[model samples]
Target: MRKWFGQSLRLGLAPDGLALVRTSIWPHERARLLAQARFKENNVEAALREAERMLADHEREGWALRVVLSDELVRLWQVAPPPGAARMADLEAACALRYRALFGASPAGWQVRADWSATRPFLASAVPQALLAQLQQAAAGSGFRLVEVAPQFVAALNQHRSMRRPGAWFGVVHGGVLSVAAFDGALLAAVRTAPIPEGADRDWLEGHVAREALRVGLGRPERLQVCGPAPKAWASSAGRLKFACTLFEDELDPLWPDSARLAMTGRAP
Candidate 1:
């Protein structure tokens, strides 16, 4: 059996601390939540000290700690590592500290927009692509499916479009997050996902969307739409990205279950 735990943080280069949202996944009722929580509760300093202890006692329990860091942490990760030596496990541990400090939990899977500065490295690295492919495989192997990478803003736009509301304009949804901004033909108060995948950056997309949001006079977006996998992680993005509405987990999951199902039957969530 496979066990998963995840958390997200909305961090930045600026003085303002990063924002975060986090959660863990288990075999529904199979795994012991308390055990998972105990393992996750370890701090970097504490984690290092308890490493052997954890490995000896809980390693066999089955658990994976996944974290979604904001842009700031990504920067730290690059320069934070000591020049001499750093283990992969150490890097992951530091990442855990950064993520935990911001969001108070660890994120298993993450979805970030194209604009965030932190996302740049991830986009360039093999990690995200691997994660994407791995996610597909995991879903297939586990019989789960991953849905569209639609943002909350796009969900609102779709909803608005269906209602036949006026003042509707162009919309884009990436990674289950939303960015709905009213286009007044003069300015756009657009909002988008911020707590993107660590190292994943939307170089050109960030400026492009923000400018468009301003140009269109993006006003307060309607409702926050929740659809597809990692909806909770999407919610964590909202705290930092500042979306107009929030999506309900139950609603989104039923409507758009994990797309991994396409690869495997009866294995989707």
Candidate 2:
């Protein structure tokens, strides 16, 4: 028989800190915050070293790790497969070429990953290879397996995609940055991110959406869906882009930064 489901751990990497969530997948999906740490210099290498120490005493021999990286750590863009493209290589080559054109740098230093497609446009992401190697080393040193690494924006979309409707915009906010995946009807058109400035309110959200819509040259959506740490005052949605925001991991999520500070050195609070 094929082994389909097993243990899994989620490592959330942000600009300032990191969060580790372990999930039991065999019986049912139950997640518990394992350990979270803040980087001394807000660097992935520093964060990874801290993470290794946190998991030094934990025993997870057969568990797999899923890393969710913040958008700032990655260069994200849309890739359209060239006409007459048929093989997987064609799609990958297209992504690589697009990456070079957009970032003006070779992808050799970055690990390019994407939802490969030949018929429609797909999102592509490139992460620093050195950061990836550190993440892999941390997992191996902790006696866990590093299975997958993905951008938090993409991961959020995959999780709540069924809730999204045609032409609706989706956003994920984390670490004071908002990552948007704009869709023209059912097809994703553009991906962009901007930092959420301090003291901004509901009107700021609307203005930002309007600017992004114009930037992408797409009509404004009639609906929007947002997930992550959103301002509470924006709950009363009477603005141009008003929508109910959903916070995943409602209880533990709000305390994300604090969780990282408090749950250090293998201590859970």
Candidate 3:
């Protein structure tokens, strides 16, 4: 049995933009997900709604319901551009300083994992510096309490690797963004998610998965596992993409059930 329950909350920030997901586990786990909502869009209401909805679901289920908002909640709201031309070197130096400050200062030495999707093109003359700057600025605001900022796909892959399950495995995270995590299990070589583009047909999503599958040396996963409950349409769309891998039953973390119990008992809200 798992020692802690990890429930990820994903939010759809704006109309046809990327989604953000916050993950946390219980038992007062020290290795916790930081409170940082990552997205390219400007929509705090959507972010709040996503978090609140997940908490409500957990609470109703009597799970512990440890809700964490963005660690840099206030800073993220500002959403400003960087002051000067931030070359990659400048960006890397800035990120290193920011990461050191946040993660080094944290008593728990915890880190933040993040990934983002943007619908708009040409955010900067080069790549979008605004979003990266905002993310860095947000991390800087966390009082150096977060150590690392990883892509969400990498986070999911690492988490699954920790489980040490063997086989060509496939996992899905469903909330604001529908993410797929596939691994060879032992090596933890690759985990990837591209934004579900606007007017994304099932073929598009499948193509994304297929690309990742190829990247990870999979002609196709032997089996697929889903985390959280996925919508019927998503499943159907994914099904059409490939003739490989059977979807398997997923066990939610026990904390969700506990949260539900507490809500039903009317003992905790």
Using TM-score as the measure, the top candidate is: 2
Give per-residue lDDT, candidate 2, residue 32: 72
Summarize candidate 2's per-residue lDDT along 63-164 as a digit string, tens digits. Answer: 776777777788889998899999998898888888888888789988888888898889888889998888888789878888788777777777777878
Q: 2 or 3, which is superior by lDDT?
A: 2
- lDDT per residue as tens, model 3, 64-182: 22222221221111011234634544443343344455446321223322221121111111112343344334433332222333333233334454443455554544333445555
The TM-score values for the models, in the order shown, are 0.25, 0.83, 0.35
**Residue runs of model 1 more than 4 Å from their true location after superposition:** 1-28, 34-43, 48-52, 61-219, 225-244, 250-268
lDDT of 3 at 146: 25
Candidate 2 accuracy as lDDT: 0.72
- Candidate 3 positional error at 134, Å: 17
Q: For model 2, give the 10-residue run with minimal summed lDDT.
A: 260-269
Quote the lDDT for 106 in model 3.
27
> lDDT: which candidate is best?
2
The local distance difference test score of model 1 is 0.30
Residue lDDT tens for model 1, 122-204: 11111234334533443234233334322223333434444333443333233333233434432222323333344333333
